[model samples]
Target: MTGHQKTAFVTGASTGFGAAIARRFAADGARVVAAARRIDKLAALAEEFGPTVLPLQLDVRDRAAVAAAVDGLPAEFADVDVLVNNAGLAKGLSPAQQADLDDWDQMVDTNCKGLVYCARALLPGMVARGRGHVINLGSIAANYPYPGGNVYGATKAFVRQFSLNLRADLHGTGVRVTCVEPGLAGGTEFSVVRFQGDQDKADAVYSGVQPLTADDVAESVHWAAAQPAHVNINIIELTPVAQSFAPLRVHRDTD
Candidate 1:
């Protein structure tokens, strides 16, 4: 509003969808506040984008830090026009019965709680300004459950519902909420982190079929944000062409 340049606050911007979204906004002449746990990667973004990108080292899991960061934004970057909640992850593929408690906790903290923390901090400003967009990163697992996807899928389900509810709450406020759910994506640290840095296993997950790239996801975000004031894109669900629904499994008695 000050200089007519939109400002976007992006979380988990050190890599993957976050970084790509930051890059897209910066290239489009928007000021971007890129926040993540990895300062080094964020620094690279700032260096590449120059003054258009402000790198902030932040862990969304820390509510205090998230609040402080939003409250302390500099004059030029304070009026955030877009908030991208893309900092989420899958911890492990273990069945619920054998899943690690730590993994479940981490997933819950980062995927669900961390997301809400950022939203709660920023939505007030957006509502007051009467103009803003909140784009959340969700997953297809939320709709289609599979083996070893117990907690991770559940967390994404929360995202789906949360986005819809925000729409209801922010009705007539001139604010927009969108949830982008991606399936079988590649070219990111998502699988690696989920597999606990097992490169071989991560590679295997995407070995055969071509999957969605970070750029693809970024483009979806950009499109949703670029819509006219009266337009609201509620949800965008995308998957590789090679992927589709499968038949339900049935177990026959062998005795």
Candidate 2:
């Protein structure tokens, strides 16, 4: 295959935004390497996208596993032109003083360190090729801190800044870095994971609100990826019309 048919590596592709992004890339005619911790779910995606979708078991928090998985990519998909770091979540809703240290550790490990691991493992090749794109999934919480988003928000802030810094570091090279921040995304595992599988709590997050869906965010990523090589979109924050910043919410009690 020609260099134009280069592959894309997407992390956290089991479901939600990650899965949607992977499928979108496949539909756009790029070979996609979809990685996630859930092998069964990845397998399902591979079945749907056919041979163009290569599903691999990966846990971003595991540094060695991340390196091994990227190193193990097939020759056809080894020369990646795009890398999407979308494997992250918020664990608990607690004040910084009352939050569990374990939850904070998990967030930092997966969101911050995991991104570094993937970038370190794959970026050298992109730098050498002098052409590539890196899209890091960020959150509105990165800018507007909420009562319960103490550490999760901080991690995303790191992602936002890191993308800019990465872009600076890659100056003169053809590689581009971008941060995609989404606010109030529904129909995904985000709130569900934040609520620790509490279906009622997860459902309440989008109650009576038209929140952004996984496809909305996926479409934004696709737009960024398809931009001309000379055009580099820095940061894009997408939110649902029904939702605003945390302090802007109006609550009503119906009797």
Please list the Cα RMSD from the true structure of every candidate, rounded to 1 decimal place: 1.4, 3.6
Worst 10 residues of 1 by lDDT: 1-10
Give candidate 1's error at residue 233 in angstroms: 0.3
Can you tell me which runs of candidate 2 are displaced by over 4 Å?
1-3, 246-255
Candidate 1: tens digits of C-alpha lDDT, residues 1-255: 234689999999999999999999888889999999998988888989898899999999999999999999999999999999999999899999999999999999999999999999999999999999999999999999999999999999999999999999999999999999999999999999999999999999998899999999999998999888899999999999988999999999999
Once fitted onto the true fold, the runs of candidate 1 whose alpha carbons sit more than 4 angstroms away are: 1-3
User: What 10-residue stretch in candidate 2 is worst by lDDT?
Assistant: 242-251
lDDT (Cα) of model 1: 0.95
lDDT, candidates in the order shown = 0.95, 0.92
Name the top TM-score candidate.
Answer: 1
